[model samples]
Target: MSIWICRACGAHSESRSGPPPKCSICDDERQFVPEGGQEWIARETLASTHSNDWTELEPNLISIGVSPAIGIGQRALLVLSSHGNVLWDCVPVLDRKTRDRILELGGIKAICLSHPHFYTGMVEWSEALGGVPILLPQADLVYVTRTSEHIRPWLGDRYEVLPGITLHRLGGHFEGSCVLEWEAGAEQNGALLVGDTIQVVPAKGWVSFMYSFPNLIPLPAREVRRIASRVADIRFDRIYGAWKEKVISSKARESVARSAERYIRRLES
Candidate 1:
């Protein structure tokens, strides 16, 4: 028996003799099953084919993405703080080279995710790096496809993972969708690593919040306002989205506020 991971979204499933009947994540409205239908691959199979590539986004933050693009093809960010290194999101494949490279920099202290779609290989990652704590929002517990002892369900709207790193739940893309705020990032002005919750659009300095990004589904105005209000006061100068180069260089706080208003006005009109 081995843990099976969905090829589409990269969410893991329980260990079994064969692949599960279907991937609930792919079937859900927020995501979609491939036209060819549901497909599954073991962790070992993924490791053999894919490898992680690291890029330094800022002084102490590095973006880790798997080569050939696995799953949603989102790149995970590693924030290096005085407290320790914090992995903000996850990729499907975690191979020996990637593990060694991270260790060479500084071993991960804890792993935090933005939502369920990025929960791929969290258990395996924790185990690979000596069982670090995996802090997942309690609100999204039902979305956890793979169960593990390393997971620490966090309650409430805010959770401080390290000295200067914090997770804030904004509840747009998912009920438990959260963003990581690094106080010392962006040359000390602060940086927000938002995974799909507040997507940094192709247009610079603009962002969009949605319930289903792939499905072109917009979230409710009330939900968008709630998400905006929750992050309205956060002092962040930069915003990083799930994909590579999807970032807002400055005035990210105002950008989010403005984006929310724009999203609401368009929907209400």
Candidate 2:
């Protein structure tokens, strides 16, 4: 038995067999446990609530897409690589169609998350991908509701999901926040798959560049510089933020540098 997030109530439940037994507090109208009755989601059962529609986002660097949770607030990115495919972040939803699509794109090799909030369907996803390794930052392991042999707790400033793909933790939103630097994003340099760690404000045209997109709170100039410094070491030509327009097509490094300086100047001034 593992902890599963209730789609309706958003509460973590120690799921053992046959749907969540009416989500303790909320009732059926609120959530539906998986049919197997033995379906397990996370290692911790106390965790609750989840969203469906693990809606797959678009893929390009290697035929990947963002798995979306309609009402819930979270995002998952799918990355297809020859060595093995990886799903970055994670939405609350997961279904057969998406599974079929994942199979078509090549079964997932691993799922690396940026933080705990995005760890929604982690266990379910890991199981769906034939026990694909779910790489988590050791620091955030406390939030893991579902414990699995498949869950590989790793520590450090960065993690290698697969060949040409690396997960770099540049603390921001969460202590273990990370961004993916994919060598395969393109042949030239690479692409940074940043969930919301460094948001792309499509509405602003410029990358929103924030500590927290949800809160609209800005990071200190020092923090901004740190993020920029961490990312600067990596060779990337583009930055993929979490939306349609959250990408910077201009000189990638230069763009980050400018954004960093601008943030610092504004904060200081």
Candidate 3:
């Protein structure tokens, strides 16, 4: 069956023919089914049903719409070079308009997700774009539902999918959590797109670590140090986060280093 959105929690799934507004995870979350009642959108329905407004935030980055009032809270960094063009993270919906827009920019070289939740419609995205591969760190493979021959796996700290783009596994939030490092990264005005593996504190334009569990768990100070070290080796002066408010300018790399080190020092002190 084609994919559909759960009316209750907005989860996208191909599990049609089940009970109305069916979603076990949302049920467990204690989020009730929608009062408007159950509704479904087929995979093909996106062509007409969903319209993505892609706004270019930088040279090779765009924030695709995640909601009328919010973007995916994840930014997609497009890598363009003699090697190829790639989208660093995946988002939930992809209609023909978006697909065509992305294709016009040299098509997608590959699709990579920083972690499980960000997997979004990656497989569907790949399929719609003529089977562009989905590169996921093997450590987070269990979270992927849409597996394809086009889905590639990276088993270690870093993988180079394209010439200028690299994915670095920082391992704080999720064991396989990552950030994209463009060869010409933020400094080139291209931006380093971090999808909350290290998050921005909008109040101060700094980065911090998070433990994998969402129940307010905190990442250990040493783990934060390690993440900082991993990211430090890469060169990116600018940084852009998923949504509009979570971004910082060309000095983000320096800020991230200082913030991470400050966090580590505080814990040791």
Candidate 4:
């Protein structure tokens, strides 16, 4: 038995025998499978060939990602909170160096994901990191290929993982798609760690929402408005997207509102 990782989207599957025939994550419309067909790599091989690079985005926030870019190539965040550290999103590689470095940074108390696409190697991550609880949204439970006892699924619109860090489900990319609100980030102005649920586009000071990012499918006007309305009351001065250097440094809340309005106007036009 081995854990097979999808080469395309980086989602993990635990097989009692061998690699699964297909990766459901890559097959979905939100993601896509390569023309060469599905490819799977064992966890051990992944660890041996690839490594993680860590960067301190701010005082208590760290960005972790795999080198050589496996899967969707999104970076995970380590949020150091007052109560405990929370890993906001996850990647495919978790080796000795990655584990040791994280341990030196006070360790992680919990793991919260933005959605299913970033759910790569989570079960192994939990087991290796002191069996910490994986706070997963109940709405996207069906996307979980690897099951573990450490997963604590939650329902509703929000969940507070620490003193000032919370997870808010805004539901754009996926039904359970969400973002992390860290009150202590951005020098106490608050920060939102949004995966592609609310994309930090190449345009500075703006962000966008999508139903299928890779497929170029746009979310309807009503859904975009609802996502904007859901985050209207949150106090955040910065927004962090999945990839590196993808941030709205100031006036992020205002940026989101303005961006949404612009997106809707373009759609209506």
Best by TM-score: 4
Better of 2 and 4 by TM-score: 4
Which 10 consecutive positions of candidate 2 have the poorest summed lDDT? Answer: 43-52
Flag clash pairs in model 3.
Answer: 73-242, 74-242, 75-242
* Cα displacement (Å) at residue 24, model 4: 0.6
Query: What is the per-residue lDDT of model 4 for residues 169-201, given as tens digits with 9 covering 90 to 100?
Result: 999889999999999899999999998889998
TM-score of each: 0.97, 0.75, 0.83, 0.98
Candidate 1 local lDDT, 1-269, one digit each (tens) = 68888999998888557899899889889999999999998877887888889899889989999998978999889888778899999988787888998888789999999999999878888889999899998999888888889999989999989988999988888989999999999999999999998998887789998899889999999999999998986878899899987989889999999999999999999
lDDT of 2 at 96: 60
lDDT of 3: 0.69
Stretches > 4 Å off in candidate 4: none
Distance (Å) between predicted and true CA of 252, model 2? 3.0
Give the alpha-carbon lDDT of every model: 0.90, 0.65, 0.69, 0.92
Residue lDDT tens for model 3, 21-59: 454423432233456655545555544555567777656
- State which candidate has the highest lDDT: 4
